[model samples]
Target: MNMNEKRFEEAKSKIVGIQRNREGIGTLQEKTVHAVLKNYYAPDVATHEVSLHNYVADIYTGNEIIEIQNGNFYKIRTKLEVFLEEHPVTVVYPIPHTKWLIWIDETTGELSKKRKSPVTGSAYLAFKELYRIKPYLKNTNLKFCFPLMDVEEYRLLNGWSRDKKKGSCRYDRIPVALFDEVVIERREDYLQFLPYELPEEFTSADLAKSAKIPSQTANLVLNILHFMEVVERIGKSSRSYLYRIAKDLG
Candidate 1:
């Protein structure tokens, strides 16, 4: 196994060991994915859940802060603002590169056969969450790490649809494997998200096609990029707005 794979295994084992010994630890209340990442990033328990300026950081490596956010980014905006004033903060967001769905019958507690989801995830999906914290994207001390993981998602078979699939509540996610990561530290690192095939001047539709993401998502990506000054609105094309990578991004 490669270094990442080895580290992942070690992280998983550390979480399992902690759970076995301390069942009701306050930090253990977080989902397995979050706990594993905390271990993966900062193995020293002393650094996990450190208090800084009245805010609890997921992991503080003495120099930098690492936050594992599995849900809404808005919730951490205040904490991030506090941390960013004095220290560099790296937000770790996990996207399921490959997902398997397992539905649990709430009534009988029986699990359905695991099936692979047709939807594959990419770093572009982060735009949705990033949009919530748009004002902080340009901060020099702020960075992002998108870890693509293979996971099994457990959901309850309680939804509005006839098959109880639509609007189902997610029980938890079990990380199966680590695929790769997209790390963005510098403003130039944002360029990695843009598709190589993109034209000099493009609309969200063109971006959506090249990035293989939905147009709505592409719009969000552009919004964040524009706010960061990575992209600028050059003009208009029909009903769509045209955008170009900023000339000073080099």
Candidate 2:
């Protein structure tokens, strides 16, 4: 949970330089967050934006493909299926463990108060995106790397609504610190993500309560758990499917 102070400062310094170099284009922009992390992880790998099996990957080592997805997993589901058959793929997802929001004024060019967002994220947040690619979770060649980070989000006014500040577009997300990473290669690795005190027999409702997450998120996590075979459908609890941890997982 603790990030290296020295490395984080260096990364932030580098991002400042990147932002300076890319100032004031406004409409068009560079992929600063993705580019910086890519370089940080794999500096030696120069073959970025690579073509493999007719699919374009973010970065490629000679033996593996790295896809940086800061948005949605569903967008790359088809590409993952095609590439996983022939090459190992690591999906690098960055979750903002802690976030600060910065809003800029369009007309006056004034920077508003920089406030910390109330949302604090965890490794479990990755499941939100993983739900869309549940079927590919158990693939031998597939792996997920979630970098838990502290980020600064910069927003600009869109000028369309009464609440100008609220109707802004998120223009940049600068990774201030990389606290830790959760890497899942095998289905068993997912066990650590689950709550230690999950009931012997539980539904999504039970999981939501046990894990202290929303029912919607619990449902998504359960879907992935079921797909990865960590849990199974034992029976039905009214409209909900009841689940129990697999014996192998237990």
Worst 10 residues of 2 by lDDT: 19-28
**Per-residue lDDT of candidate 1, residues 1-250 (tens digit):** 0237788878877764645322322234678788888888777889998889998999988889999999699999999889999999999999999999988887976778899999999999898989888899888999999889998787888999999999999877777788888898888888887889999999999999998889899899888888888999999999999999999973
Clashing pairs in 1: none
lDDT of 2 by residue, 94-213 (tens): 888899987767677666677999998877888988888877877899998888888777788664678676557887777777778888888898777578787788899988888888
- By lDDT, the best candidate is 1
TM-score, model 2 to reference: 0.86
**Residue 111 error, candidate 2, Å:** 1.8
For each candidate, the alpha-carbon lDDT, in order, equals 0.85, 0.78
In model 2, which runs have C-alpha deviations exceeding 4 angstroms?
1-12, 18-28, 159-161, 237-239
**Number of the predicted model whose TM-score against the real structure is largest:** 1
